[model samples]
Each structure stands twice: as structure tokens, then as C-alpha cells.
Target chain A: MPSRISMRFVIDSSVMQAAGRAHPVDKRPKRCRGFLDVVYGCNHRVVVTDEIETEWRQHSSRVAVMWQRRMRTHRKIWRPPPDAIEPLTDAIAGVESNRREQKLMQEDLFLLEAALAADKIVTSLDKEVHGLFRNAAKEIPKLRRVIWVDLDEPDEDGAKWVSGGVSLDPERMLGSSHE
Target chain B: MASRSGRGNHDSKQQDAGVTRITVAGFKSIREEQSIDVAPLTILAGANSSGKSSMMQPLLLLKQTLEASYDPAPLLLDGPNVRFTKAGQFLSRSQKGEPGGEFRIAVQLGTNDRVEICLGKTPKAGFGVRRLTSTMFGNTYELTPEMDHDAVRGQLPLAAKLADGSFPEEVREQCVWRVRQDRCFLGVEATHGDGDHWATFSYLPAEALSHELRNLIHLPALRGNRGRDYPVTAVGESFLGGFDAYVASVIAQWQTEEAGGDLTCMNGDLELLGLTWKAVTRRVSDAHMEIQVARLPRSTVGGEDDLVNVADVGIGVSQVLPVLVALQVARPGQLVYIEQPEIHLHPRAQVALAKVFSRAAKRGVRVVVETHSSLLLLAVQALVAEGKLSPDLVKLHWFTRSETDGTTRIDTADLDEAGAFGEWPEDFGDVEWTAENAYLNAAEKALRRGMKDAK
Candidate 1:
């Protein structure tokens, strides 16, 4: 039998904060830690980026501290990759389309770029980034075949982060002809 | 066969001059006349079946034939234990070579001195030397009136026998003084004057004239990993063949005072594997000997200080023992060919093994190897760049399969003085750079998302 291929997630800092469950100090890292536990149990890896690493280095947030501790113990957290130059440029244009002539932000550009590179879900709670990525599947040829999994919408059980804002089927996202 | 008219006078390449160049045509794998200019240390490398062995096979074949048979008159294409088969085995069938080609070999000894032999096949018999052509280089000299007629008459009969394909008897004591003829045999008994730096221009058989040096000691990758008792013969050459043949006994006899004695050579190599040893070899009987190994005092293992059979310690020790012994025992100025000396060794020791060969070469022992380790290559290059060894002394041939023909093409990856290669390994660099770049991009994306959500 073929070995199970684990899915990789380009985990953002906001999700890490929710996973940290650090607010009242007496409670469990309440929000996204549950989602992480679910993904962790299902053999999903969280790809942490340099930006995420720097933030953790600067603040030593509870979630970041826990990840730092686990870094030595497991191969779960990894650095993220970017979408190719041509594909990334087209994805950016798609994100900035139908908007006022405002420049794309570096931080926002990284999320969309990394999602395409890792070919994984950009597990994010940001709705704007979700719209940007879900639309990128409409522009870039390589990314057109990959769906951006949105983690903002929780499942009815409130325990799992369900796919939101984009179709889960990759076949539906493919066939986007980029000029 | 080409005819040689010995109207010229020059110097014949001496034994001390070393083999300058060896050219082969219709030999195994080599389709045409390929001349390899020998160096102080020449290395032959190519992948398995890529003709690397074919190049070396010629030398080994000649060497083995000299020892395996009494008939030096015949260049036996196939011996009982030799590599190649009949002459047809070496006959080139490639596009560049003739379909049923004859085997021709030439060894360029000196400027104008060379011995070329051509071997052809008949209907019933296999391939053997059909003709011998040689020009022994000697200086200009006019025959004086005082020359001995009696000694000169003796060589004419030998030349007449050579004309009828008869062998020349060994010249017992001194080099022979000979008077030149239009065509004659070049033999040990066929030299001019007292033979003081002077060679006779005669058409002697290839074996009788050149006497190709058999100073080579080839030990095919050893397999004596069992560490069992091996029988040692008290006579002949001390070198053993096979993977691990008599290596234990060799170690017992060979351990030197330099590395603190008692398998010190073996232990020195083991140290590269993060292992130090207390080695002991005992003779069970007149014919039997066994070797045992243990962790040395103040050395590290997993905490048990017990002696165990070398076989039980691990295969790395077993696989490496012969290599260790060969490196230590090989004499100076001898050519040694080792296949996969880094076999079963860790990266640190593999890198260190490259040093062993480089150091061996520096000591005037020509070491040739076929390696599969990139780390070993990197280490050798680093040694060259640091001026530890000259770049000219090192040669790297990367064997790759050709798309045009299925045959292997050897591409020389030249190493500069700074140890930089002309061509980088494909899997070693670009793939790694791409992966690292991808990871960094993803990491940055994750951090950016966290920052936005916090704001």
C-alpha cells in the first residue's frame, strides 16, 4: 500500500495566535488550537514562514513559544514557499482587479504567493486574503488548478476549520485561461 | 601492421621514465585508438560498464598473462581468472570501429621509441599476436673495427629463429651488444655495446623486448567480512586477494608503532567512523587465525566494555578492514586500484578516505580509485584549493548515459586551483536552492498574515 501523503498548510500568524489559546491564562488556547489539534491528528504539517518566524522571535507569543518547543521534537512546522514569479505577478493582478488603484501590500502578497508555492491551503482567518487567494485560482495557470482552503468558517461542530469561500474540487478551479 | 624502418636514432623510454603514454585500439569498450598520457598519478573513472574498467583491463590482462602462463609469446586474450574473453570480446563493434577488428596496442616509451603489436584471429584458433613491430631508440654510433664476430654471429641465428616465429632464450647475465640489420628481433639479448643507456633497434617479440612492468598490485574490493579464521601461506607475495582475505592476519602482522601499535592502522580508520578499538588476533592453530575487536580505554561506545567478534561489531568495520590494511601495506611507487574505498563508511570517514588517497599519492604511491561519494569529491577539491595537492594531479570524469547512443560518455569535470568545478552536480545545488527558496517564501507569507490579523 502507498504511504499516506500528509497535506501541508502555510499557517499564518493570526491562526497561530488563535491556536495559542492565551488570553485569560486559566483557559486552554481556546480558538484555533482545536483546529490545529484536528490537523495535527490527521497528519497535516504547518509550514511556518520567515515572517511568522520573525514575529515569534520578536514577541515569543504563547503559540510561537509552543511551536519553538515542538520544532526540536517534530518535523511539523516548516518554512513556506512562494508562487513562481510569472504566476505570482498574475495572481497579484487578479487580487487587485476591480479595486481602486491601490498597490498590493507585501504581507498580503506573501500569503497569496506562498499558497501557490506550497500547493497547500493558506489556513487563514483573514477574509480579504481569502478573497484574494480564491480569485488567484482564476488567474494563474498553475494555481488555477489549486483551491485556496479558507479556515475562517468553522464547521457546525465548531471544532474543525472547514473549507470556505472557494470550491474544494480542484477540477472546478482548473481550466482558467490567463492572457 | 605498420612497417618500421629503423634508419633513425633516438632514446628509448627507460623503466625509470615511467609509462609516458598507452594507446589502445579494438580493445574492450574503447572503439578506436585512444591514447591516455600517463601522469605521476593517473586516475581512470567511469560508471559501471562505462568502459572505465575496460581501460584498466588491458594493463591487468597483460600483467596476469605474464604470471598465469609460460607462453609470453601469446598475449592471451582470456586467461582462467582474467576479465575479458577471446579476442572477439575486445574486438570493437561500435560505429567507429570495424566489425571484426584486430587488437592493436602501442606503448610510447620515449621520443622515437615505441613497441606496437597487432593481434589477429584465424578460423580455428582465437586471437593472438600476429606481428611485432618496434623501434628501440638508441644514439648515433659507427661500428668500430674491434667488434666481436663470435658474439655478433650468435644474434643472427636468434634473428633467423625470430623470422620463423621461434622464441628467444633468456639473456642470462648482461645486456647483449648487437649490430643492426634491416629487420631483427629486439630482445633482452639484443642491445648495442654494454647496453649502457643504449637499446638495440630490432623486431623482437613484444614480451621479450618491452617486458611491461608488473609492479601493479590489484586488490578487487574485499569481501572477507565474516571475520572468521583465514589460512595464511608463509610463502610468495604477502598481498591477499578477495574482499577480506587474510586481512585479520594481515592486520596482526602489519600493525605499526606509528598509530600506537596493535591494529592501530585499522583503528585509525575506525576512528573516522567514531570508533576506537582494542584489537586482538590469536592463532588457533598452525593454519587458523582469528581477529577480535573491542572498545579502547578512554574511547567511546554505548557503555559496554566487552570484546566481540569483528563481524558482530557491524558491517562497517568488516567492510573497511581490507581497505585500511591495503592503504597501510601498499609500497611506494606501486600503482594501487581501489574500487569504492568509501564503501559502508559514514560521510566523515568517506571524506577522510579521500585524504588517505591524496596523502598516498603525495608519498609517490600512485592511487587510482572509483568513488560514488560527492562528499569525497568535495573533500579532494578542498584539498586541492588549499594547495594541499596540485589541481593537475587530480582528474574527475563524470560518467553519464548518452541519449544519442546508449553508451556511456565520460565528461571530465575540470577542477580549478581554487577547487571550483567547471560543471556543478545537478542534484547537489539547484534543487536544494529551489527548496530553500520555497520554504522561506512560505514562512514570510505566514508571518504577514499574523501581523495583519493582530492589527
Candidate 2:
């Protein structure tokens, strides 16, 4: 049998915030850390853009501040495994569209460029920004886009409902409540 | 191919006298004359089995000629040929039996000197013996006698000693007499004693000639399994040292101008990110060592710092550094062949590689690359279009297979400064996306609909 194709999901801060997870105290944002923990442990690789970190610092500063406060109480919270934080300067430098939009899009553009460059499925929860990413994906070979709902939803039918922005069956979105 | 037009702006003051041209004859499916000029940046493209690999054969052949130890058997023949009709299996065609099956290659090393190597198979003259003649320069040399022993070991010394002994004592003393001069005809008997006899004294100088040829670095294509076991660090070290010297020269020009605040600060920040001036070292063990960006301690958080052992860092940083290190370490007068440097890299990083190749070319390293990614191609095209690299310095060959012969044909496309080529084949951009095939499929569907409507 052919080897199964492996993929990576690079998450942005906006997607993390939408998941309602507490921000990570020392390193990446809370939702990002949770998403990374889940994805990294699985067969798939997970990556975060410097842009995502910068955005978390700007739009999600309160989360960062909260994490900073928590870190004071828990000194161990600030440390990350050496392999976890990969600086994407070279990957980021390769993106032409990102360079063109550096002034206007800032960190978000950097994250988008990283997603496109990574040649893996970019997982984001923001519907508004999907078009820009999808268009960029069209220009790049092997690049794709996936939403958080698609990732969390167990079945295609359940994913369809969540993707349509409906919460008719909360259990489907949340998984088994008995557990 | 039609004549191409365009004069790219000279980005660097360094002048390229021009690339050395290689001509191949009777190699594989390439029955006729084939030539490829190794420009600063040369791209070989063609459809499957179309002579893209054949064009590269000369390089391999040159390597085989220069490297005395490499076995040349597997490089000569393709797969077994068989013909099975309703009748049954029959002995198939032999590639060696084809018209002009004999192979010859002439490599222009420089303006003044060129080496032409030829190989031909002759029928078996006697029991357990086949005649093979290989000629170097204008001198006709036969290898049939030496093939029983070691042809390379036996013949190389004989050829060199013969050439050397032919030189007159006075010319030998001068040490710089041209071969064309009649005074340099040192007799073969003086070196080898007599015809067909291996002289004892001839052994030492032949060994020396073989050593010189062995020193030539034969770069292999990325796909081959043979060189895969070669340490990545060794390749990285060579590429990095060459790349660093080139980058230093390019940066020297920018130093004279007053640095703009935002740009300088941004560059400084990027330098802190460990994109520039990072050392790469390989441990005796399998571990790869590279300088990487890391968060400073709480007291020195804002201060710039570099952490060693890049492999311990994220995959993106570790994976991308190899290309930079390779480019940085490439030396002048060396051939750097890379296959798909864009693999696992972001588009931004792809653009960075383009600049890296451009900078390397300016410093005198010849780069030959094969890529499937358009983004990477576009980035290089952009550099060419912007006049950062000369149009003549870059040549792109598109390969397509001939339907009749199943042989690949290569066509050259010239990229203008705007990254636009004069003529793009219908199947050029994407192999999966074909307008002609799509239109034909649509027409077939419409015709079927008309037939159904009539029914």
C-alpha cells in the first residue's frame, strides 16, 4: 500500500480565540497551544506563524497578559520543548504576495504566506479571511485550506451543519457529552 | 526553436566570458547531434523519456572519464528490449546495434582547450574478446586489448605516457610546449618501451595522471540513490563556504549608502532571527549543527542572541537552512545541480532561493536546476525580468516527447525581464491543465448531446 500523505495545520490566533480556550501563559496563545497539542500528538504536524504570534500580541494582548500573570505563579509554564518553536524567517521570506502586502496586512499576511508556503492544509476559523487565503492557495501548488469545524466534527454531515453556521445539534459539535 | 531576443541588465560588474558548450553524439535516443551550453543558470526540461536525462549523460560520461574508479557499464545501456507478438517472445533490438550506436562527446573546458571522448563497440575478434575503441583528442586509441584486465588502469597510463614520451626532451624541459608543435612528438617507445607492452617505468606517471582526473568533482542529479549516502554535512559545508563569500561581496556594495531607519531596523531584526551570519557545523556523529534564533533570558529578553543546534528548533527552520547553507557554500568554477529546492519550502523562502542563486551566479558558480514548481520558476523569472540577472545568463529548456519515437525533445524558451517567455508550449505551465484536451473533451460531450437530441 502507498504511504498515507501527511499534512500540517498552521493555526492563526483568530482561530484559537474562536475556540474559547484560555490563552497559553508563556509561549503561543491558549487556543493555539491546545490546537498544537492535539495536532502535534497526532500523525499530522502543527505549525504557528510568527505573524500569528504577533497578532496574538496585538489583538490578543489581554490573553498574553493573562498568561504572563499566570506564568509568575507557575514558573514552569514559560518553557517549551526545543523542537516546538521553529522560526519561519526563511519560509516567510519566500512568500512574494506576503512581501507585497507586508505594509497593509502585517502579521496576518505573514501567517497566510506561511500557510501557503507550508504546502499543507491551513486551518482557520475565520470565514471572512477565507477568501483571501483560498485565492492565494489557487496560486500555490499543494496548498489547501480547512476550517476548525471540519477538523473537530467527526462526520461529514455534522461538519456540513457546523460549516453552515448552525448549532441545531450542539452534541455533534462538542462530541460525546457522556464522556 | 525561433531566435530569442532580449538583453538583460548587468547586475554585477563581473563579466561572464560565456559558458562551456557540450556536444553529444550517438547517446541513447539522441542519435543526432545535441548540444547544451552550460550558462550561469541552465534548466533542462523535456517530456518523460525525452532526452532530458540523455542531455545529462554527457556530464555523467565526463565524470566516468575523469573518475577512474566509477563503473561505466550501467550508464551505457537501458532496459532489455523484447518483441512478443501472437507468435511468441523473440530476441529484441539491441541499443548498441542501432545506427550510430557509438557515443562520442566533446566538452569545451575553456576557450583554448577541449576534450573529445568517444566510445564504440566492435564485433568480437576472437574467443572471449570484444573490440572497443575509445579515442581522446585526435589520437585514435583502442581499448580491446586492455578490457581483459582493467581497461582504465591499463590504458590511462599508456595514453598519457605515450603522449608525454612523444614530447621532445627540449619541449619537455620547457614544460609549456603546445601539442600541435611538431617538436613535442615524444616517441611511445621511450615511455612504454615498445608497441602493446606495459613498461615498468610507465606506471608512476600514469598513476599521477589518473589522480589529477579523480580530483574533478562530478555532481550527480538529486534523484540518484548512489550519492544519497554521502554525508549532507559535507555537501552543506562546501555550499555554505562558497555562498558566504558571495553574500559578503554583495553586502559590501550596500554598506556605503546610509541605511534607512525602518529598513535597517527591520534587517537588524531579521538578522537577530538568525537568517544571516549564522554558523553551521556538523558533529562527527549524525547530528547537524546550525545557529538559530532563540528567546533571550528574562533579563536579556530584548537583546539579540543565537542558539546552536538548529535541528532541535522547529522543522521549518531546520528544513529551510540546508538550501541557504548549500548556496552559501558553493564555490566558484563549480557546478551546483539542485533538483526541486522548493520542496517543503514556503513561497517567501522560494523567492529567497532565487536571490541566492542569482548571488551565486554573480560570484561565478554555475547553477543547473530542475523544478516542477511554477512559483519558484516565476521568482527566478522575476529576477531576470528585473535585470537583477542577465537574460543570456539564464536559459530554460522545455522537454517534450516525440509521439513516433518515444524520445524526448528539448526546446529552449527565453524569459524576458518580466518573467514572461516568448512562447510557452500548450503543455508548459501545468501538465494536468491542458486547454486542447479540455476543449476536445467538451466538444465530444456536445456532439453526444446533439446525438441524444436527435434520438
Candidate 3:
């Protein structure tokens, strides 16, 4: 048997905009596609919620179109449960009064709901998502975790990797401590 | 004639930009992003499960996927090269997350030339060149790290201009590649871009990159020497997992097409194996090919050696034969990844194998060795100390596991001018140390008891 463990991940829209550029002509500093490439190459499951897709459409539609050309429904994206939304908002509110955080809007909550139902990770560069993870970590022991990554930073800088919430070192996510 | 000249011109343009660094992340035991410097000879030294193969596997995966022509070229997990089924089987647990997570790999070809590739899950999973930066006009990053990009834009073009002046007018004026939004949808740009932002240079497609990866001979550690008559196959994939089919194909190729010197080298290796003066020759049947070893009498003065079946020889000879043949035919700028080239060999032959690596490196081939034999390492050191292998041309990486996180930690072993090491890992083959100590202790106790009885 192989020594590696199967793992899960979720990517956000802000990072998707930084997918690879059209070299020579397209001059931009987006290395975010590297993160996705590594995950997929390693054969880990990736989940993308509809709300995240909607957010991606608002900004990184080009990358979304690129995915359309090559996307396959094996372990790439998760089918969010229809009822994941209400429970996620209730879980978040029960954990803390995050009803007014503007940076992470309703779609992000949907992303969180999608995460909880499937036990997927929420990878976001937004501080609001990190705040929600911190709150959920403190108040809701059974709540699923999020992984915060800063793709905008240079490779040599601090915490450019997927850092775990709920105090997971090397940055992993877990909903139940039992597992 | 024009096309051939164009190819030569293009190769000469990028010849200075050799691949320098490789980075692997979220793959197997190598969960953290790790970078390894490529030298003419790189030695990966580690105990079991220390992430040496994991680092090399990323390149092999890409090579195999490209060989199979996997769609989108980089995202497929299951293929002919490896039997990987799902993402979970290989992802580093320390680095992976729920979904939408990814593992990335990048190769820095030179100072300013690099290609980065990423792979994530399926059903929205796609893999290809994530980022590619190159100075097709032969630009290199000779600037200080703190130098501004404005300085790069200023200084790099001047260097490229000065160097590119000697290039043919066709290469100097023509646009060879273009970039669309897909980044890797690159081909010959039929239409000129609207602005000066156009790179107007060469493009190395995913297949080209994969070709670079395929220019390697990866010998897994679980190799064996014994074989019966095996079927022959095509040229490149002939040396698949085991030497059964691969060795026959290799021998057949040797008989029909190889230069005479290849067999001479193989004979020299056989001599080192103490199968003194025995030469390897093949017997072809209607159904199969037989590799036979001939025994030579001590009088090289004037006697012909008759051939016998390779199976008649010890397992060690059959094992080391292909290894020697492979090294003998290695071309310049090729990569050879050997798991344990010293397997099933006597210490002397194993040491001879070290000379093989030194010789291969001297031939301009890059050799990547992952071995458990201290003799091989000592032989390499001896070669270095004797000034046969240059110190700068050699590299060593010591893979050790973290006590707390249980992940791998690879440290570059520093080599100085005299082929001495700054630090060597403790546990490659230290079991011999323990066994020797046990023997000494028991011998001393037995001697003492005998003396007391005599008194």
C-alpha cells in the first residue's frame, strides 16, 4: 500500500483569478494555478460549490471556462446537499454573531454549508472566512474546519501554504475529532 | 535545410538555460513544498520511506501521462505509467485539504525560465502549465535579488540584444509562439499580437516538457536478474517494470544496431563481476532470444570462449548486465534514476558500479542514485577524493523524517573541494555497526571465560 493519505480541498474565487496567465502577452503575477495543479496531480478530491462558481463567474470567468474545457466529474467537484445552507448559517450563528460580516457574503456561507455536508475544506484568502473559521473553532467543536492560504504572497514568505484551522498543523481540516 | 537550421538556432538560443531546480509539493511523503538543485550527479540518500522516490515520482508521473496522451495532459491520475486510482492514494496528508485543494510542481529551467504545473481533483479538475516564463531570446536573471523589475526590463533586454545579434535574421525577426487565455494553447502564432508585450519568442509545449522528463531511465529498487525466455516489445517502453522483456529487447537491439563499444563496456563490467573474461552474446530462436555468457580461459593469449545460457551464471551477473549496458548507451544530457544499482552484486562489483556512475557523469549524463550500499557511497567518495569526479559536479541529499510531524525532511549534504561531506545521515546501513559490535562483545566474553578456566 502507498504511504500517502487521501485528502480533500476547496478553492476560492479570489485565488482562481490568479490561475496561469497567457505568457508574454498576459503579464500578471498569479501563481494560484500552481496550488490547484499540485492538489489535482497528487490525486486529492477537490470540491467547488455552486456559490463559489457564481463568485468565480463574477471575476475569474476565464479560468472557469478553462475548467469547462477539461473538467471531469470524478473526484473534482462536490455536489452540495440541497439542505446544507440553513444548517450552515445556523451553525455559524450559533458559533458566533457573524451575520454582519460583509467581506464573506451569503455565497461564502453556502460554501461553508457545502463544506460541512461533504466534510470538504474551505480554502479562501479572505480574512472573513478566516474569522469564521476561528469563531467556529472556538465555539463549535463539531463544526468542520477551513484552510486559509495566501496565494498573493511570494513563495518565500510566511504561511503561503494551506494552514489548518482548529489548530491543525501543516494546515488540514477536520469536522469530528473522532476521526 | 532551413528547418534544420531553425532547429539548431532555437536549441542554441536556449542551450544556456539548463534546468536548475525542481520543486515537489503535496505528493506522497513530500507534503511540504521542497526544492532540489539539479547537478551533473545528484545522490538521493535516505532510509526507507524518506521521500526520495516521492520527489522523483512527480516527474515520472508527468512523463508517463504524456506518453499515454492523457487529456489536458497533466490531470489524469490513472494511467499506464502508474497504477494510481484516486487522489487520496498519493496526496500528502500534511498538505491536502477537503476539496478544491491542490498539489503543485515547478521546474526552474534557469534564472528567468521556469514552468509550473498544478493538478487537483476531477469533475472540474484540469491540469496543464499553470505558469510559464521564458526569455526566448536567451534572457537570464543575472541581477541581484533586490533589483527592481524596472532594472530587469532595462538590463535583460540589453543582454538579450547583444547575444541575439549573432542569431539568424529569420530567428531574429520571426514570431514563433503565441499565448491565448489557456496559457498552454500555445503554438506557432500565425497572427502578430497588437503590442510590444508580445514575447515574440519560442514556446516549449507540454509535450516538449514531457519529452524532457521521458529522457530518463528509472530503475526501481525491486529489480531482479533471473529470467526465462521473454517476449520482445517496442524500443522506449521495452524496459518496463522488470528486466524480463526489457533485457531481451535491449540485447536484440545491441546485436542488430549497437556500436561495438557498447558490448566492450558490458564485457568490462562482466570482468569486474569476476566472471573473468566471459563475454555476453545473444542467441535468437524463432520464438525467443537467449542472452548467453561465454567463459574465457585465463590465457587471453589465444583461446576462443564458448557461450553458455545466462541462466547458468550466478544471479549477480544477469542483474548487473543490463545496468552496465544501460549506462554504456547513455547519451549526453540524459537522466538516469536508479533505485539500487548495487542490488544483488558483490561489494567489489558494487564499487565498480560507483565508477560506472562517475563515468556516466563524466559522459555528461545526469545520474540520480538512491542506494542503501555504503560501499557505493564510499566508492563515489573515493572517486571524488582521487579527483576523477569533480566536487561541483556532484550533489547529495540526505532525507530524514521529522520526529514530531512524522513528515520527511531533506537536507542537502554539502560537498567541498576534496569530496568530503559536511554531514551524512546516520541510518542508511548502520545495522552492520550493531552486528559488528555484538560479535566483538561476545568474542571478548568467551576469551575471558577461557582464561579463567585455565587459571
TM-score of predicted chain A against the true chain A, for each candidate: 0.63, 0.41, 0.64
Candidate 1 wrongly placed segments (more than 4 Å): A1-179, B1-22, B37-43, B69-81, B96-99, B105-118, B122-125, B131-213, B221-227, B234-246, B255-266, B273-280, B295-306, B400-402, B405-414, B423-455
- In candidate 3, what are the lDDT values of residues B126-211, reduced to their tens digit? 43333333333355323222234354335445433543544455554443223322322222222234365443433233434544
For model 1, residues B326-352, the per-residue Cα lDDT tens digits are: 655554444566666777777887787
Off by over 4 Å in 3: A1-179, B1-19, B69-81, B95-100, B110-112, B126-208, B224-226, B233-246, B256-259, B275-287, B295-305, B427-435, B445-455
Top-scoring candidate (TM-score): 3
Models ranked on lDDT: 3, 1, 2
Q: Write the per-residue lDDT of candidate 1 for residues A77-151, one digit (tens) a residue.
A: 546444341235544665446553224333555554555556545555566755555455454455555544444
Q: What is the lDDT of residue A22 in candidate 3?
A: 31
Each candidate: RMSD: 16.2, 21.6, 26.9
Q: TM-score of each model's B chain?
A: 0.65, 0.56, 0.73
DockQ of 2: 0.01
Comparing candidate 2 with candidate 3, which one achieves the higher lDDT? 3
RMSD of 1: 16.2
